[model samples]
Target: MLTKFSVTAAAEKFMRRVVRFSGLPSSAGFRLLVRTGGCSGYDAEFSAEVEARTGDETIEVHGLRIFLPAESRVLLDGLKIDFIETPDRSGFAFIKDDQRSVVAVSADVARIDVSAIGRG
Candidate 1:
């Protein structure tokens, strides 16, 4: 798969549902980013970006691709990305990476298998 880690059935299923409903093409990819906001000082956002690899960790969720910036990896440590497609709203969220307030970035993401971690 495109991701370094595996994904969960729930995550995979959700991804497909979103894509199917969005009617986007196969070449489309989901972009993950970290920005300042919320009470947590930073939050995550996902969209579509076709830029070059930037050496970041690219994970595959469901049949779609999730791109993480190379420098943003540590911030995403222990970060759990999830897709929530509700009747009113549909998008991805930063479920969890590291609950602890450390260096904003984390080393935890390095140990995770994007695909397998989702199932866990």
Candidate 2:
């Protein structure tokens, strides 16, 4: 599922931030999997995988490496992840190319100027 869009800078930043916030053990790579749990019968999961699967596509963006299975690469294309901090707390967010969900930003994350700290 090779496309013109491999990964974006904002996506890379999201991964780096997740690593720092998770405090998980360091390894050579990260894995983003498409699991079955969401209302759409699919959910995105982040984990540490020691190695990439043979059918996985390795995306290296801004020094952050992520491996997504060939099957997942399809749904993940043109997808961007971001972190949000509401009054309740902080959590991750997602955006797809097809359309914006109620929770979607409906804006360009690259224009948001998300630095080390959160900005509205």
lDDT of candidate 1 at residue 12, scale 0 to 100: 61
Candidate 2 weakest ten by summed lDDT: 105-114
lDDT of 2 by residue, 34-93 (tens): 544555445556654556778888777766667888666775557655555556544345
Segments in model 1 whose C-alpha atoms lie over 4 Å from true places: 1-24, 51-53, 83-120
Please state the error at residue 67 of candidate 2 in Å: 0.6
Return the clash pairs for model 2, or none: none
lDDT of 2 at 83: 50
**TM-scores of all candidate predictions against the true structure:** 0.47, 0.57
| Best-performing candidate as measured by lDDT | 2
lDDT of 1 by residue, 1-120 (tens): 223333345546654543444445556565556665544456554444444267756666544766777644655555555445556644434444344323232112232233322210
Instruction: Please list the C-alpha lDDT of all candidates, in the order they appear.
Output: 0.48, 0.55
Error of 1 at 117 (Å): 30
User: Model 1 Cα displacement at 98 (Å)?
Assistant: 8.6
